[model samples]
Target: MCSLAPHPFLSLSKPFTKRTLISLRNVIRDSALNKPGILADSSASPSRDAAVLIPFCNVNDVPGILFEVRGKTLRSHSGEISFPGGRIDSTDKSFLAGALRETREELGISPNRVEVLGELGPTEVNLRGNMRVWPYVAFVHGHQINEKGTLDTPLSSIDLEDVWKHRSLEEVASVFHLPLQALASPVRLKASKFRGGWPYWAVDVSDLVEAEKVEHGDGEFVDEVGCGQEGRIEIWGLTGWYLSLLTRILQIHS
Candidate 1:
């Protein structure tokens, strides 16, 4: 039971406007409220719970989502591409607080700059522990940037480097963004399978999502994420599954 998707967002030619953002916020808020959490049953208790922010940004007027490449220095999951988040802290007031705190720590984007929209859930099982992941959807906001790279004009495109100052090399290796439109374009789709042993939709987003101030090389991303295309970021596994849920919720076929 899902309706036809991709039609509603097929013609998003123009840059993301204030009105468009408002519409998206409403949709996310409403849809999120109705969706059930992945762990509705109390049969099991995970060793750890983590919170992540699925941050959406408008780049050069186009809607896109941001991702991070983890530094190799980390103990676990090093050199991986994922969202800005980590294990929930004891001091955090709520799951949203943990997500916002992680965002600020990893991306330099403050909680005030992001409009928290909603959340999603999916758990992970590993030898270390069974973990529950809570993903909060948010819109990153910033001052206007003109061609001259000043904040004098209305909102246009935000140079992420300008906003990303606190992200450390020890924690995050690089930051990139994948355009929303590119995800739905048939030409960009690639044949692939999920780690869970089923057909999965994959998209090569090398051209649209460029890394800024990243320390790693392009070739390593393929190894880290098992991308079929060389030097390109492929949306697969959990990332693609999350995108699929969002697409279905928004009725955007991909």
Candidate 2:
């Protein structure tokens, strides 16, 4: 299990001040307003459509973002840290519903507990350049944190130890929270380049006990390739791209 610790510089005692929430809402609104125009060109006739929820929660009053480590046995994106979501199902009424449904299936979090803030726009993932991902900003309500600054013992009505014991084990290995303040901090973000000279951003997670070395698709481990804290547990690819957009919004609003 990964240790859930606040960044050294963040004071958990005072997390989401009124001003912070206001700023966050403002950012979400601005993104929603500007998304359509920004994505109109690239999003046309996308090969695939999917949605992901960027869930914000106040744990011990500290604002953090929820992420799931995909189960190793999964066929796609195994052992990767990602936002809770998946491809749109035929029965899904809307992208929002699909995102929420996937969240519930992956993390056992009820959609009622998530307060949708707004959409952050659609973006194309680098994986084969075929998938389009619509991201939604949301706040998770009623979930509490313990004195240790971790999720309350029985998260989403089940004990922490039993998180992987559920049927979601086929998709999710474990769930974890990363402090939004830490991600928004300049010191924690590093600038890098991706294939074809594309600009990329990554968060430093070297201090995290859960950070592990990433293995390539060929079953070979690359020591210094992917983006992550010190090249380990790379948060690169589409996940890194989405988080980069989030950190940018936070920086502007901060």
Candidate 3:
């Protein structure tokens, strides 16, 4: 059974207090961070495992985030958009450890190079009617990678110049709002099902969620809800929920 405890996510309406922001600054100052050896198993019923890294790099004087489109060849969550992390391995001492490990494996991110900024609460899921999931968050410094001396490398060597570009938090927020407003719109609720099943929704302007059909200018397709705006960041599913909360907190502080 799932726990009744509520998870805490970052809000966008208000910026963090000076003290809180300072705390985050302090976390980034840490001298050493450990790495997890490998990722964990995803088999069995309601098991606890999985960690994801919200990797960020400073490019052209702005923070740019790294996300992945899982290769369609994968067995689970194929071709979905997500962070560079995965399931907790037996070697992982903790959830944070697992997250860093998976990120390193998938995106060639080094655990030691990433400074932890704390984690958001976990999200639970039953994959394929089995495999329980727990998702956690961590912030990383935005810096560039040197080909020879850099701390990481691309696992797939696939081109990411288009999606992995520098985007201001404000731009990200504007894109986010386009969907939050829609979620409140009656049109969305009519399509949303009960909690017993899946949470289906989309944001046309920045439809990040996978369930919702992101309009790609080819004329809207059926069963696919147009994400109002064209070519905007699509926010949906777990990533959408996480972004929504993060934006709320950042906005509150800013």
Candidate 4:
């Protein structure tokens, strides 16, 4: 795996699997050891049970993180960019188990097939402390195509299992693996005010998967933001905050 400190990337740097991805894994593992069995930002107890997995993977030797576009009909956070996870059930052995279960349900990637790296610092779901979400970092085996038609991950690792099998217009619209090269770029994510009040991060879907090396379907564009829609697709709010924390650990993005 590649080893390098934080630095500015010009274009898509090298394959992240051969670059910073390994470094990030090491950092997350070390951080977990330094902390407790699970990571939380505050000691206050939450009233609800929910967890999310910040899944990482080496798709065809290129490293990236997995994300999902929630179906527009979900009870909460509909049509938003999110990780593969949901409410922790009463039968779940732990928060990690809930996270893995959701991952299996959302992407069809089995639990045993993933290597859990560690836990990311948990955050309050509503900023009011009533509900908190514990996020896990892991390496999963699979690939997927984004809405704009970029086959970032092989549809079945190109064959074994179709990662998009669970997708439906009312559930998970699409899955995407945001490459580390664009992730490491300064311009990849921009800080902006959401709803004219909350400060958050936003990235144009085009800039995220626009590298010439990105494979596309016969001149298909790489922008998932404008799917004939009027608004932008942002990695902001809770998802964006966690990403900020992850990038800081990898020391790749400012």
| 2 or 3, greater by TM-score | 2
**What residue pairs clash in candidate 2, if any at all?**
none
lDDT of 3 by residue, 159-235 (tens): 23423342222112111112222333333322222233533333233334333344567887532322332444343
Estimate candidate 4's RMSD in Å.
Answer: 9.2
1 or 2: which has the higher TM-score? Answer: 1
Estimate, for each residue in 127-154, the C-alpha lDDT of model 2 and write its tens digit.
6666678888877655432222232221
lDDT of 4 at 24: 55
User: Which residue pairs clash within candidate 4?
Assistant: 2-18
Better of 3 and 4 by lDDT: 4
- TM-score per model over all chains: 0.74, 0.72, 0.50, 0.70
Error of 2 at 172 (Å): 1.3
Evaluated with lDDT, which candidate comes out highest? 1
lDDT string for model 4 (1-254, tens) is: 12235634312434433123344556777753336544333555679978989877655555567777776567877767778888898989999999998888877777866767777763545455567777888777544322122323222222222666754446576677777766765554676653355444555455332222323789765543212123456576677777766765666553
User: What lDDT does candidate 1 reach at residue 176?
Assistant: 80
Error of 3 at 210 (Å): 16
Give residue 121's error in model 4 in angstroms.
1.3
| Candidate 1 least-lDDT 10 residues | 145-154
Model 1 residue 185 lDDT score: 73
